[model samples]
Target: MNGILLLGGHSDIGGDLLTRLCAGRPVVLAARRAWTLTEVAERATAAGATEVHTLDFEATDLASHRALVDRAADLTGGLGTAIVAFGILGEQRRAETDEAHAVEIATVDYTAQVSMLTILADTMTRGEIIAFSSIAGWRARRANYVYGSTKAGLDAFCQGLADRLHGTPLRLITARPGFVIGSMTEGMDPAPMSVTPAEVADAVATEITDGKGSTTLWIPRRLRLLAWIMAAVPRPIWRKMPR
Candidate 1:
């Protein structure tokens, strides 16, 4: 039996996705601290996963991504589904002065995602690649352009990749979640159309499994209209608009 590969099982969205998905199928959870995530596996098992495997995967460690993909394929006969739910959000002030911190987030958010997807996409003959991007990518937000820029790059990358993989049995699902209630966004004000882990997971499940052919999934569905309105606004006005 094949397995579903989740690069960041430790994530709230990732865990929710795994719980709702992979029923009766083995799941492979990859993370930096593999041992610390035994409960992740247990929960997946309880959620009807056939089995669960753990792996060491550091998002920023680009060199190890090849090895990670190799290991994932070895565990499962073929990569049926790949969910990249790995990311980080740090203090905006700290990231401003710390050049290394800024670059680290950017690399992890964009560079490493490309590397991992390339490796995973190559090995995945037929499956869906669901990437957890953010609506922040749509435009540069004054509050968090550092992170926004990274997500912007990712969103564009996914679009091009989706076009490239056209008619090849390889599906790419770029998920641009608005404000998600998760560990990362703790203490922050949830955006207007905030969603939950389960909701995002459900949207992805419906889009991919049901053969919707929708490469981009804007959470809450209405976000499609919202994004259009946002895009039509003048840049000068957009810059001044409060987030």
Candidate 2:
């Protein structure tokens, strides 16, 4: 089997997913601070990965994306799976007045994601590419519309990308999870039906192991029902919804 590459090597969900998928395979972890990947790399090694490597990655540097993928492929011989898991849930209040902050969120969450996914899809001939979406994108809320909007755009992009990959050897697994209670959501009140990183990892890993074709998964599965309810909520009330 070819090896696996995780773009956001330090991400909570990405780290967990790697442990689940890395057995007997060469693993590459790419992150901004390659040094920060030590713990995750150790875990992958303990989990039976044949080898673990780290590469410096800067998500906002769009020009470097393809080179990063090429380097990863060289390291692993061939990349069979790629997890595009880098993103930021920018502070909505500050983003309201800070143009730079808002753009940072957009670039990281949406634009950078698009850049990496496209590179992976075009370069890798087969295997899986994992992208993350969120229920916040189901409908933007006033509290976190900036972040929500990014997810909304990303979810739509993933939908189209899935279709484009249909019948091809490459498959995209877009995970639209609800509130994730992790380092990202730290200090915020956990939303109803919140899920943990391990839970999200389990869901995606299961799909990679047992599923076929491009698929979109609602983590916890029942979130699909809630996502439908989210849409039916009137705009007036929806605008009042919490992040």
Candidate 3:
């Protein structure tokens, strides 16, 4: 049976997307804390997944990523999709002052993502690798520069990688959503054009199911124009805007 794998299965968006993608398919939910996914696995099964399995996945552990990919392929007949949904929205203030915190943010958000995506690209014979980027990457704000910078790097990498996969069976979809109001941003004020986890999942599922296979996805569509406007803003003015 073919399957869908969620690399960051514990996140709200990941959980939402998993339910949407798992219909009539086996699913592998891989996360740093796999044991806590009993409820998620149940939800996937209830949503029509043929079967569900949770695997221990450490984002920073590059050495074991390939093995994890191999196991997923082995468990199911093949992977229909692999969602790279793991990332850290590190505290900007703390990251600015602490070197360790900065490195943790960069490593998890960008480095780990690239490593897993590279492995998935090389190993998967047929599937799509969906990654979550943010509109924040379009232009780094002084308030959250550390997180934004990592997403910027990831977005650029995924774009170039998509170009390189021109004739390949595998594809990459980089989703750039505006501020997502969710558990991740519990106490923070919502930004304009904020989207819910289900909304993001629905848009992505439609893109995949309808064969859009577009290299990039702009949630709510208007984010595309907003991204351009943000990119064109002068640095002096950009730095002054409160994010």
Most lDDT-accurate candidate: 2
Q: What TM-score does model 2 achieve against the real structure?
A: 0.98
Q: How high is the CA lDDT of each candidate model? A: 0.85, 0.92, 0.89
Question: If scored against the real structure, what TM-score would every candidate get?
Answer: 0.95, 0.98, 0.97
TM-score of 3: 0.97
Candidate 2 backbone collisions, by pair: none
Which 10-residue span in candidate 1 carries the lowest summed lDDT? Answer: 87-96
Measured on C-alpha atoms, candidate 2 has an lDDT of 0.92
Q: Give the per-residue Cα lDDT of candidate 2 at 17.
A: 95
Among all windows of 10 consecutive residues in model 2, the one with the lowest summed lDDT is 211-220
lDDT by residue (1-243, candidate 3, tens digit) is 368889987889989988988889999999977999999999999999998988999998889999999999888788979999988899999998899999999999999999999998898877688999998888899999999999999999999989888678888988889999898988999888899999999888888889556889999799888888888899889899877
Candidate 2 residue lDDT tens string, 1-243: 388999998799999999999989999999999998889999999999999989999999999999999999999999999999999888899999999999999999999999999999999999999999999998999999999999999999999999999898888999988899999998999888899999999999999888654389998789889889888999888878777
Rank all candidate structures by their lDDT, best first, as comma-separated numbers.
Answer: 2, 3, 1
Candidate 1: list runs displaced more than 4 Å. Answer: none
Candidate 1 lDDT over residue span 9-109, tens digit each: 78999888888888888788999889999888988989998878899888988899988887888887667889998888765677889999999889888
What is the RMSD of candidate 1?
Answer: 1.4
Q: Considering only N, C-alpha and C atoms within 3 Å, which residue pairs clash in candidate 1? A: none
Model 1 lDDT at residue 138: 87
